[model samples]
Target: MNQTVRPERRVLAQRVTLAHGGGGKAMRDLIEDVFTSVFAPPGMEDQARLMDASLLEPGAELAFTTDSFVVSPMEFPGGDIGTISVCGTVNDLAVGGARPLWLSAAFIIEEGVEITTLRQIAASMQKSALEAGVRIVTGDTKVVGKGSGDGVFVTTAGIGVIPPGRRMLAESVRPGDIALVSGVLGDHGAAILAARGDMDLTSDIRSDCQPLNHLIEAVLTAVPDIRAARDATRGGLASALNEVAYAAGVGIEITEADLPLRQEVRGICEILGLDPLYLANEGTLVLFVPPDQAVSALAAMKSVPAGRGARVIGKAVTAHPGTVIMKTVLGGARIVDMLVGEQLPRIC
Candidate 1:
């Protein structure tokens, strides 16, 4: 990767640069001369002014968040970053009991990346957002010298409104509660892995990257007292349940026999030495509910198209609060902990 220098912009030389990603004069020129001219909306004349990563909206009761997508192959078995960008943010808001309304997308594109790919990605994103009933109200785009940027990087911020009287947060969890998952886990991570050409086992996995807002709505309607909820994305089911336990100061006792695992996913995990519990999933929801409503809640979740496989995976325990234990079918016990680090980075 050859470096480049251009003094006109008065910027230092770029290291390991491609013509598009160069930080030298070409980079500044690209921003000020090309991108700004073509894509910059009137309100966003200066990228610097966008530094705080915020917008002007008074008392929106916003559920604001940011997420970056770096999945190795931009396209995968179930979806590309386009759908991932939309679904991920939608789930984040849905988990918080917010109805996602608006989204802002920022792209860091490598120079020399095909325009065709970009178009397809945008279309996929648009379609996904429409299906989720959200709008892409604003966005930003930048091109780095080819090497500095991967094919592309996407960061999205979502704003959603929480429905009245439907507060969902970890603090609402309590002992004697139950943890329900919307579907079989590990599909998203395995789908991603399969797309990477890791033929550890025959490919039969699909990314669980569907939007969960409908399922969330159903659960809310069925059990307004739902304690807490989370989408199992980067850290898989084990990590998600642990967060609930930690946040609510409750113990989680999960039964291995009750945990849902598709046969294909189970086989792949066995071959890859991957623990399905720690793999990423895009389309699953983890909900905390009062033990009394657990059955109805599971029924409600299973009733949704996206939650057909919903089941009670575990229970909140009074003893050993803040800890998560797994009860094996053989009558043994094991501990489940937070993902100390990335079991698989760039999974989302």
Candidate 2:
């Protein structure tokens, strides 16, 4: 007798569809097969139950932050939307003097996106969260029509604990304080532009996208007296420093030559009519410390791998309060104002 043969069952959907977002069996299967399978920790409550919310520790003050990622191309040289989604929120908390703890992620996926791509993004998020010493305890996913959404958009919310007596704020900065940067700037913005292949320009620039909580922790540990810290994100170092100056009622004077910039990034900015100081950076931070302690702070920061390129770029001053001025390389001074509008849009 001949035996009947059956076709093998496929484990993944070839493409996302309306049914995948309808909260039905298909949706559940997609979540289970793609997201939950990778995000849930071993012996945890699973992804669905994890979405209910996390329990906080007793007598803990929490730092909460939320950010959305809408970078074009989804993937970049050094990182992707998934990695930035986690790192952005984590850095937000860290700069606020918080020890990052748990995170919640939400996904808006467009129909017709490949399941394999979604899985890759989730895996990247998992890797980033692990590196930052945080847990992805909760998340939600929704699907949109093909034309209604980009391939994928991720929003991440993070919670962290602010250690006792550690208060880092823009308002805390004062005149005579020193300004320091963690590393080379504008790599993220330049890398994204090159990745788009819009200008047909090519260079070896890569995005400086990485979690900065570890680096921040090291600095805080060594110099708890640091007045302020801010990560250079959307508007880059220029905007971040302007915010500090305005909040603290002080002026900031930076030397053009002291600012860290990669040669390739400088060339890219020159070719693209961009300023490296105003370009976005994913893994860079600007710190304000008392001039007396600037040496110790810079040393502490340089001890960490992430801060090896750290430099004392400028100083907070009383002259021209609420403004930022740069001493140009050629014995000239220029006003570095806050960016009037978006230099680059849909970037983080």
Which number leads on TM-score? 2
Structure candidate 1, residue pairs in collision: 20-144, 20-145, 21-144, 21-145, 21-146, 22-145, 208-283
Compared with the true structure, the alpha-carbon lDDT of candidate 1 equals 0.79
RMSD of each: 7.6, 5.1
State the lDDT of candidate 2 residue by residue for 70-160, as single tens digits: 9987898998899899999999999998888888889999999998888889999999999999988878889999899989999999888
Kindly report which residue pairs in candidate 2 clash with one another.
none
Using alpha carbons, what is the TM-score of model 1? 0.84
Query: Distance from true position, residue 321, model 1, in Å?
Result: 1.4
